[model samples]
Target: MVHSDEYKAKRLERKKRFMQQAKKNNVFKARRRNNFSKRPNFHNHQQENQQEQQFQKQDSTALRQRGFFQVLPTDDLPQVPQCSHGPCLLFEKKNGPEVEETFFACAIYRNQAEFCDFKLTFNKETGEIEVKEAVEGEEDAEKKKKKKKIFGYNRIPKALTEMSPTDTVLYCKTCINVFPNKHECVCEPVEREALERPTHLLPPVNEQHGESQFFFSTETLDVITKAVEKSKVDGILCIGAPRIFENIRALHPEKNVFLLDYDKRFAKFFPSKQYAQYSMLVDHFFDKIAEPKLMEFFDKSKSILMITDPPFGVFMEPLLKSIEKMKKRFVSTGKEETLFYSMIVLPIYIRKYVLHGNFWMSDYRVTYEGHKLYQHSEKTIVRLFTDLPVECIDLKNVAGYKFCEVCDRYVTERNVHCDRCQACTSVEQGKWNHCEKCDKCVKPRYVHCAQCARCHLYGRCIQKHDE
Candidate 1:
């Protein structure tokens, strides 16, 4: 049978594309093989690699024997100043003690990029950190000039919004752009309803650098939204916490709710006026349209609430600093009388360090839907730390918690009021016992060591709780 001219031409076009792709693949394979062949003395290097592995094992063992650590865990760490990027963490040299023992560097230094230029030398004996100048050579300067990869952003056409609710649009995760159809995308594309519940179909948590995202479970989202409703704030600012923003927008579309998150996927899913591509660590906004939109949110609401569950392992200082910068920006928008409030979710164990400057720990434990550790209600270490009035945390609908009339706050049922402290002292696991020598409530496992002049389990870390 003879085909029509249009049908034959379509088949020919498909054949050309297939041939072009196959040719490109073959060229790539040949170049990869050519580069592999250029390696010097491959067989001789295998023997050297084997010896090097053996040496590394022995070296690691020796380092462990001497109590030298590569990374100083969070519990062992002390409160440090914040760099523009989240927090500064301490790292050990893993070398001889005669040399530098420890130093504080940017948390993002190794995890993502070397954008932060802050470094400090720690005096273990004196417990002080001094700024250390970074030495930049010519090679280092050249690397600095080479910027990281940046992708262009494109909005799904507003015309799609005028279509039926079931109408869908195409989005490409690889190109970080949206298109009307796969033929125009030039990248692998997924189709979803642009106006209706597109957030439900967002790509899984970003495994890439510069962000760590774990969304809130449905129950957790309910509790947060309820809290915002009771506050009756004019606006809600969700930093690195998109679920709250989405929930508030869905349930109360009239209320002014905005999201600032590092995940650019949100930029594609939500309208520019409602969401912004934000980085909490560097306090930067990648999208240009976000600045005016943020100011617009500020002006509409005299009272604004900021809810943040930043990336795991972030420090308290930088998080607070970034919020202040945002708060200042909001105040500059001519709403100074509108008090700014925030609820920062963090590990329960770190309450000791973060309970300053109007921040109070709430008994409402926050859990993630798919997180490995924080998914459980009982053992989850995550808790809400808020500057709002402690009396405002109503956990009547939640389980395993009781209200403390004396302190006017909610706490775990395991927490008992300490007559001496005159407050509910229990934080993480069990009821606390007041130590006569320490003159304060301490964990039941704590044993006061007079020589050390502190309450701690000897030969163990004090910061590590029942995990």
Candidate 2:
């Protein structure tokens, strides 16, 4: 008994130390930063989430950690079994990031989304691929094939009328699938009776993986919904903001809200007609049928409003190219480029990317649901960048903002219009002080340096900043 007590004490101490180290290394992140972000992330290289460099026949082609789902220019692997993220890559047991059998995986594969089930066993010795038929019950197969169109926010599957009490109504969080009440699962399954509705059982994909999936707060969703409500367009394209898409659909049943997101779990909520698994950065659609639907929407609607909340640090160059491609595709359908405007939600720090695109940042701070930083208070970094007229932003509904006649823009009440600059100039963080030397308004933290002839942090000059 004394030995057992001693072992318990030592184990508890070890656990305490491990938790401290985890906190220090940022093991639990609110938002996953990209490889190029100023923020650094410590990955568990030996654990399940580790991504090792691929040593394959085609050395040039590799899976990008940044989650840019671009189709690689390689022919080493056969394209017969292509997944949503394009051609699958061969993963050998020897060079795998985690302990695994030799297999092929979707290029942008991640456990969080569980977006694709496109794993094929590849024998390194035999140089052959093994295909396994998915053996699902006929009832489950029928339930999957019966894609019910969700007309309203209360997305009750119409086919549920046939569901009996003995049906597989229990949801297993570990497997992210519904199972029979008595069926074996990794953990205790959530009872159907415990939920307010069956749709409530659809677990939120809150984990950070290849792409960050921070949902918008109810307040943020309300603000965006108001904006969509005032729009003249009947078609709403929610590129990455699923919350916004659902809200728009719920409130305005007259209008159609289409969701184009990378999260495959969202498929359970929405029908294929309304939702498409897509990577906006590379402008690739996971489903072949998705394009025609979007094109049809574009052709039918006289005008469409695009509101995107893309992952942070997404390659702006390719994103712009994708937008341009959308416009081109619309034009090719023998229809004039409809009145398509965009409202992109991004960090205020990366305003340089949208500088020349006729995109202007509204004074309204875009808050999020589960994001650690952009939740509330002074740390609100996300803003609604839009191509719509400044007057279109209804700051009157929200607080802390007013319309500036001189600047012809909506700005925070803290922002003082700079007559010399002829612009509001103040960003989302707070008010900015105008520097006569730089002839522009800079952040409150920046100091005008005479030597560098620019506004920057104290003791940090451009010459030595890189060092």
Candidate 3:
């Protein structure tokens, strides 16, 4: 078959365009690779890297001043201060309420409208946060920043500013450049980390992972433990603590200890009876063990304090319950011990469970995910705790799909989908991965000739619940 003249000409033009584009792409890739390879020999690269480190240090210091931390002169940011007990970036408000919300990257304060008892303040004069005057122009300036038309400002959190892409007019310690955005910066994580949080006193957590000193950074761990211990909480309960919790226990053994997890293997490390004393609720982090179910173990009469690394997104349960009990008793009374305490790292599957109500605003140590993957803010923490109730729901709605402990949700022969497959089953499989062949959940090591795009487990990854 012969093609028409117009078709042939058009086809040739298209081919020429494709070749040019491909050639351009290849050239760009080559240049990028060459530049990366020569970076070590480039003295400017080292100098830029050092400058970035200095900028990050400045930004990190600024971060601690959430409501507004003081920016010591470029020459005078004190030696990361003596954070031997708490977080280096953390600071005491010095004058406000005894317990001020903790900000990972910023200082937080409350205006009089939010709290009638006393307005929280940040004193630049005394470095003491006190109840004070409404600074004129400050609110307007901040509102102006908020009102600016920026595509990602709504999605991007204020906490992310210090860590986000380096901005030309704003603080971005990563690239050491005053560039408007981080999109093109070629800064390394090490340089970023250095700028975000000075490590003059302690090395990176990874290098010290196995070593006892690194494993237990006395400064950080002690600060974390003391922060919890000093709190007004009555008895403390810790679950699925990973190895870090052990450090907490070693530091403050007097705090009540309860090890709750599905990991029966750890039970072997402790003698049977001792382990038994520490109640093992035998629930996965993702399981929505009903609040009523938890009630059986809770003594509502006592000032009970609870803690757990709840599956992601479900951290709001305990706070909601505490608010519920608050209607009947004083919040400061510790009446909701069954559902209150410090940090809880939830997994992705169960993260959205907390969005149904005002429970998202419970005041506590920190509602945080480990690894600092995103913006860490004390303002977010405080907002979560102090917000008033607008609506309430039975906590189980957020719990997620349900399946009995002894059900086979995965067994199928004729292209079957199990309706009973509720919670994740791969915990039993010991390995979790996508199966390109089955187009379904399967062991990570599955080998097959054909591949499918869908996951074999929950089918396709369900959209992360709208948080």
Root-mean-square deviation per candidate: 20.3, 13.9, 25.7
lDDT of each: 0.69, 0.66, 0.34
The CA lDDT at 119 in model 3 is 29
What's the TM-score of each model vs. the native? 0.65, 0.63, 0.26
| Model 3 C-alpha lDDT versus the unseen true structure | 0.34
Which whole-number lDDT from 0 to 100 does residue 5 have in model 3? Answer: 100
Rank ordering of all candidates by TM-score, starting from the highest: 1, 2, 3
Off by over 4 Å in 1: 1-154, 157-159, 162-199, 206-210, 460-467
User: In angstroms, what RMSD does candidate 3 have relative to the true structure?
Assistant: 25.7
Q: Model 2, residue 38: what's the lDDT?
A: 40
Clashes of 3: 29
Worst 10 residues of 2 by lDDT: 61-70
Which one wins by lDDT: 1 or 3? Answer: 1
CA lDDT of 463 in candidate 2?
32
lDDT of 2 at 150: 33
Q: Kindly indicate the candidate among 1 and 2 with the higher lDDT.
A: 1
- What C-alpha lDDT, on a 0 to 100 scale, does residue 62 get in candidate 2? 31
